[model samples]
Target: MSAPLRVLIVDDERLARERLKDLLAEAGDMQLVGECRNGNEAIAAIDAERPDLVLLDVQMPGPDGFGVLRALPPESPPAVIFVTAHRDFAVQAFEANALDYLLKPFDRERFRQSLARARDRRKALASPLDTELLARLEALTRRPPHEPERYVTRLVARVGWRMRFLQVEDIDYLTAEGNYVSVQVGKQSHLTRETLSALEAKLDPKQFLRAHRSFIVRLDRIEEVEPLPPGEYVFVLRDGTRLTSGRSYRAQVQRALELPT
Candidate 1:
């Protein structure tokens, strides 16, 4: 007989966590091996138990679900189903190849659907740590953690709260910040959990334009580009916010914008 799928529940809310456990208990196909209330705890449980699936919450006290995901080795990806209260980050979650999402106030049927999908996908796969999986994740995440195919969906800002969710659409540009990438948004800039190269892959490139090694702009948000100096231009945003264009990205950005060279 096929081994029963093992699952780990990671959520900050006690009631939500217990409720999910109860839902799983009602079903006979999955075995709930462990439950955690925070990312830190979830990481420990994941490393020790190595569950087949993880029901991860996007928000938590510290080292949130994304942190727990980052903490794991890339080779051992546990199919993740995001349980989030915030709907704005849904696209990013799915972009990360999450099995499914259970918004708050989840019903039994929805839970079952998500669980079934995870199981079916798992059954169709042969091994987790194989090269094909690694390449797919690399193409998605741009880098492999100890667990390939996993990229951080949240950020631990350098000078603020321990956790924050900066959706991919919220990003206006990407700038290399040493080992990480600084994501520019409306008024506040956030440091992401992934490298610049990784963000390039994980992000929907059609929306984001890599203007420079240290700069990327949202294509739809650009208002105009004005010639400034030799092979240099000024990027005017939809909001009239302007930034200097990087030298290297001039031709490429021009090509994307369909501007005369």
Candidate 2:
């Protein structure tokens, strides 16, 4: 016998939202406090209700799931379990050390497994630091650094004949454009001269992750990581553009997290 687990559901798709809600209902012991279609609304709900857990979707119109998590204060943030369809984005999700994931068209068992993991993670922690954990949680969620010893002091991208400097913290995500890598910061995009592989070596693995063969993301700025069909995952940043993840690198990304030995 224990207290009913309070939960919130966030997703952009109406059907997806309802389906998850139904799944939670079947479990019987959990309470469905409410649902939101986007991250902005979800954040408001989180601020007001302060639920114990959030079944968050990676992609949405504004303030996607990751955005909601980022916006949360460290003092009392909720445990997050992502419900997505993208396989590539799994790397990012694993980086976050997510409790579990329920792929789309979820069955009873998958849903149950997700809830079980969430419950276990919640129970394992002696005390929760909502805002603080939210801040540190990015380390586990974004692409890990290349080596623990080295961190990105500053982001340098080769452009044409000159190199431009941007703080690593300023970048939202890195995208591959043909033979180039794009530094996405806020609303502007800057071109860099590097292939995805070469960039991986130069960029710190702890802060930047290779999500897809062509895409790498800054851990702190990721707004959402969603699952997609045809064997792939997609991620959306705070800027509202969606990108795909690389399926092959999923395991490598997971290993970088260096979870409990």
Candidate 3:
């Protein structure tokens, strides 16, 4: 008697998406509106499709599930079921006011329960952007407070449906491209749907320096720092990639490279 709930599935893993698709099909009361492999696509789908519910994956390259939720400006985003492979994110997922958090490899019964909960909560108009939930999510994504001061060791990036895990040491530099950040590693570069400011917060300041508004360079990778005329400077990476430092960031750049100002 009730109208079928429109649903969207967002996950980087093909098998995970396929499994959710099959399960949703088996659930008689829901209709699949669209499928997105990454957070960017998911955000676009949410804007375009405006589905009644979103099955969001907790971890992915770029925006991830939490980032997607934070991006939505509405007080009440469509119902969401946080699907993730990591059990450690459960508390934070709920704290972010999710409809439910579905752990990876969930059985049909568990999946159905999650779906049912979402269905029941569909009418709630409260926004998922609660301050408490957001704070928890921010903490969850960073290194634990108790651990010794450390920087992120790995970066996850998604291209189409493929996910790439880049080691921090392998990264040559980072450049801002509009709303995305280009993660350059060796000859390969992956565009991630994340703001430079947000990504900078996660990086270790000791190893990476924001040489310019649009650029973040790895300290040990600098092969040379050429002092250009007119008080400008250019950082040459070990691979010969040249990144110009911004005029306003000159002092920080000098200090970072230990160049006498």
Off by over 4 Å in 2: 126-261
Question: Which candidate comes out best when scored by lDDT?
Answer: 3
lDDT of 2 by residue, 1-261 (tens): 777789999898999888888888898779999999888999999999888889989888898666776577544457778888765565555434355666676787888888887676445343323456434543443345664554445555433334466667788776554455567777556555456676677677777778666568876565766655544556566755666666786665455533222
Over the stretch 8-84, how does candidate 1's per-residue lDDT look in tens digits?
99988889988998899987888999998888889888889989899999989889666676566544467899998
Quantify all predictions' global Cα lDDT against the true fold.
0.70, 0.68, 0.76
Error of 3 at 24 (Å): 0.5
Question: Judged by TM-score relative to the true structure, which candidate is superior, 1 or 2?
Answer: 1
lDDT ranking, high to low = 3, 1, 2
RMSD after Cα superposition, model 3: 14.2
After TM-score superposition, the amount by which residue 99's alpha carbon in candidate 3 deviates from its true location, in angstroms, is 0.7
Over 4 Å off, model 1: 127-261
Tell me model 3's lDDT, rounded to 2 decimals: 0.76
